[model samples]
Target: MPTRPNYNQSSANHPIINTNNNNNLNQISIMNTNVDITSYVGKVLNINQHQVIVEDVLGQGGFAFVFLVRSSNQQRYALKRMYVNNERDLT
Candidate 1:
């Protein structure tokens, strides 16, 4: 039998998942608290140390909203914001 590869290694590209026994229920809340679909145009978000400016909302789904954005270097990107109300779906 082949040995399983260790995927929990630390890397800049991957987020580390700590399997601790700390159960902080206070931090476990719905991803989207706002019910209204507010436009994020003209707003800047710092993701991964890069500044991305929201241009407009491209589309919206039952649980997600895709926004058209541009990076500080003028690169276009589509940012998807999803709402996970059900805790089971998070797993």
Candidate 2:
């Protein structure tokens, strides 16, 4: 079997509110919110004075990549990118 790259050491921590099961599960939230905005082709993202460029990367054990962008006009924001198998799916 082929080994996959390790991407699980990059996130923060947060408390989750689970109301489904009687058991309360405490999970650690990753803080690896780096995103490569350049990869978002054709996608229009609002850019402001507070906006920052970030690199998209997967946090250790993270299922997805998130972007941490700050807007001068507004507060900080997190931009998430969905991984697609093909470019055509982007549409």
Candidate 3:
């Protein structure tokens, strides 16, 4: 009877799963906590307890400001504040 080749042994030499890929995966696990928000004002409008505001001065013909907010559950989100010519124009 012929014996089957060891598939497990072949997988050990696979090019896709190597040392370099392992190192990259380790680097991605690190978290970044240092970010400066002071210089962004004017460029940024208002900053709330859970969000950051910034001006959309480019006049893309859409919104006026942008906001970065964090949810109660810790999820991060971006909010856009549009420009309205009149207070009543908002809907």
Reference-based lDDT, each prediction: 0.53, 0.36, 0.30
* Model 2 residue 18 lDDT score: 21
Query: Which residue segments of model 2 deviate by more than 4 Å?
Result: 1-52, 55-63, 87-91
Worst 10 residues of 3 by lDDT: 9-18
TM-score of each: 0.54, 0.29, 0.29
Q: Residue 65 in model 2: shift from native, Å? A: 0.6
The candidate, 1 or 3, that scores higher on TM-score is: 1
What digit string (tens of lDDT, one per residue) describes model 2 on residues 1-91?
9553443232333222222221211111223447533344223343321233332233323444444433444344454534444445445
User: What TM-score quantifies how close candidate 2 is to the native fold?
Assistant: 0.29
Best by lDDT: 1
- Using TM-score, rank the candidates from best to worst: 1, 2, 3
- The sequence of per-residue lDDT tens digits that candidate 1 reaches over residues 1-91 is 9532332221122222222212422232234557444446677766544567766666667776656667877767766666655556557
Worst 10 residues of 2 by lDDT: 19-28
In candidate 3 the C-alpha lDDT for residue 61 amounts to 23
Q: What's the true lDDT of residue 10 in model 3? A: 14
Which residue runs does candidate 1 get wrong by more than 4 Å? 1-38, 86-91
Error of 3 at 89 (Å): 1.5
Q: Which prediction has more favorable lDDT, 2 or 3?
A: 2
